[model samples]
Target: MPYNTSYVPNYIKRQARMVLLLLVLFTGCTEVIELDIQEVEDGLVIYGRISNSNSANEVIISRTRGPETAPTPISGATVRVIDNNGLVRIFLEKEPGVYTMQPSDSPGDFGNSYRLEADVSGRIYRTDFQELMPIIAQDELRYEIGVERDITSSGANIENDVVRIFGDSKLPSDLPEDFFIRWEIEEVYSTLTAFLPVFWFPGAGGRGQCYIQNKLGADQIYLLDGRNIRRSDLNNRPIITRKIDNSFQNKHYFNLIQSSISEENHDYWEKVRTLTITNGSIFDPIVGKLQGNIKSSDPEEEVFGFFEVIGIDTTRLLMTNNDIPVFFVDPCLFLGDKVFPLLTVPFGCVQCLLDEKLIEPGCLSCSAITNSTSRPSYF
Candidate 1:
C-alpha cells in the first residue's frame, strides 16, 4: 500500500503554516502566523493497512517531532484488527512502531467487516468498521512510447520521449452496485554491473547482474470514485510514466496493484493528494485539514493518520528496451568505449572515486546500489 510519510508527519505537527504548505502550496499573498511554543504538543499518528494479501498488511505508529523533521516512531504499542464477530487478531511488533501479521493470522476476508484498535499506555484508539469489498482485477495493462515536456531542477522545460503505462478494468455485471478504486505501481528490473568482483561485496559476489525494485509514479495519485465513473468499465486510465533511463535497458516489470477501498478511505487519499500536489496558482485554497478514521478515546485528544481495509489484486506488464523506439545510450557505456585504450581495467570499476560519481561508477559493483538483490526468479 502507498503511504504518505511526509504529509502524515506534518499534519500531526499541527502547525497551521505547515498544513497550508501541504494542501495549498502557494497563494496570492503570504502571511506569517506564530504558534506558541509551550502550547505545542506532539500528536499521535497511526498509519495502518490490511488487505486480502497478508504480506501487504502492517501498521506504524509515531509522533510529531516538531518543525522541519520526521516523526519519531513510538514503541511498545498494542495493535490489532477486530472483525464484526468479535474475533481479534493481534499484530506482532516487528520494529519500533512497526507491527505485522503473519499468514497464519486472520486474513481480511471479503464480505466481512473489520476495524483497527490500538492500545497506547492504557489509552485506546480505534477506527470505524469497514467491510472488505470484492476485488477489482485489471482487465488489460499496456504501455506506449510518447514524447512530453518535462521540467528540470533548474526550471528549464524540455521535450523528452518517454513510456506511459495505462490500465483498463470492468466491474462485474452482478451484485455490488458501487466501488472505489486505488492503484499502486511498483517497478522491478534487472541491471548488470561492469565489473563482477571476486570478493563478496554486499549484494554482489561473482555475479554482476542484479534486480532492483522501487515505487513507480509515486509522485502522482491514481484513484476513481464510483459515483463519478458512470460506466461499468474504466478505460485507458493513465497509470504511470517513466523516462527512458537505465531502468528500461533490461527486462522491466511494472506491478499494477489494484485495491478496492471504502469511499471514506478514497476521500481521505483524495484530500491528501490535493494537499500534496500543486500548480502554484493564485486561486489555490489557503488551508485544509488532513484527517483520518482513527480516533482517540478521549474526545479532547488529537490523532492523525488512517486505518484502511482493502481487497487487492495485482497484475504485471513486462517491457524491455526493444519495446521503445528511441534508443537510449547507457551512461556507463564508457566501460566498452575505447577512449582509454591503454587502460587495462575499466577506470574506477574496481573502486568508486571522486571523478566516477558522474557516471554512477558504484553500479560497477552492483552491491553498492541501494535495494539491489540477487537475480529474481521472474527476471
Candidate 2:
C-alpha cells in the first residue's frame, strides 16, 4: 500500500472548516480566541494489519509528538504474531520503525484467532486474540457518469464531470446481525503522451509514447453494519466518485475491496472516521483519546491505533473514454510552438502559459501527471 502524507493537512483543514460553519450557524457569530494548550508526553502509536491476500503484512510503530511536530517512528522494537495454535512468527524490521512478516510466513488464516505482541524498551504491549471474520464477495461493480458543481478555493463555482462507482452485495441471512462491513477502492489507469512533440534537452532521455499505470485510493473509509441494513442485498450503492479529468481521458480501471471486520475493529475505525469529520465542535461527540485492542503492561502508559485481521472480497471494473465526459483543455496548448518552433503560435501564448503555470514540466509528460511509467499487469 502506498503512503501519502499530503492528505493529512487537507483533511484537517476541511474538518476545521466544518466546525467553523457549524459554529456560525448556531451562535449567529464567531469569535477567535487563543488558548494555551500544554503538550503531553508522546505515547506509543501502533498500526498493523493482516489480511487473507498475498500482500505482505506490516506493522508500524511510532511515537506521537506535539501538534506542530511530526510523529517519529520508533525503532529497535521486537514484534511478533502468534496464533491460537501456538504458531509464532517474528516480524523483521525492514525500515526505521516498519516491521514486515516474511514472505515464507502464512498470510493469515480466516476464522482463526491471532494476537500481536511487541516489546518496546522492555515494556510489553499485546492485543487480545482477534478472530478474522468471513467476507461475502461483492456481486457487482459498476459506475455512472454525471455532473456536479464544485466550489474552488476562490469560492468560484464550476461544473465538474464526475464518475461514480457503485457496488452490490448480498448478505447471508444466517450471519450475525452485527457483522461489520468496510469498503476500500483502488484505481488503475494508463497515461499516454505520444501526441506531444518530442523535445530533447541536455542529458534528457527520449520522450515518446510510454504506457504508464498508477494506483489511486486511500483516506476514504466507508463502514456499515448488517443489523442496520433493511435489505438482504444492496444494489447500486455508491462507493466513491472522482471528477473526470485528464487522468480519465483514457481507459481507467477500479478495484473495489469489501471486507468483513470484527465489531471492535469496526468501532475503532468508526470513531476515527468521526473524529476526522467532526474535529472538535460543540455539536460533535465528546472527543476522547482513541483506545485500541492493544494494552500496555504499565497501566499509565497510553497506546493508540489498532491491529486488525480481516477477510476481503474484491471486484474490478473497467471504464473507457466514452464512459465519461472530458472537460479539460488540451495540455499541449500551453507549449504553443515552444517544442515545435516552426509551427505558427497563437497571440499572448507566453502570457497564457505563465498565468496558468501550465509551462511546468508535468504538463508535457502524461506519465508525470498522475501515474507511473510502468504499466500494470492487468493493463
Q: Tell me, what's the RMSD of every candidate?
A: 7.5, 8.2
Error of 2 at 291 (Å): 1.7
lDDT of 2 by residue, 276-328 (tens): 23211111111224567889999898787688887766677888777765654
In terms of TM-score, which candidate is strongest? 1
Report clashes for each candidate as comma-separated counts: 1, 0
lDDT score, candidate 2: 0.60
Q: Best-fitting candidate, measured by lDDT?
A: 1
The weakest ten consecutive residues by lDDT in model 1 span 20-29
The residue-level lDDT of candidate 2 at 321 comes to 76
Clashing pairs in 2: none
Which stretches of model 1 miss by more than 4 angstroms?
A: 1-41, 149-159, 196-204, 273-289, 326-378
lDDT of each: 0.64, 0.60
Instruction: Give the distance in Å from residue 88's predicted Cα in candidate 2 to where it truly belongs.
Output: 2.3
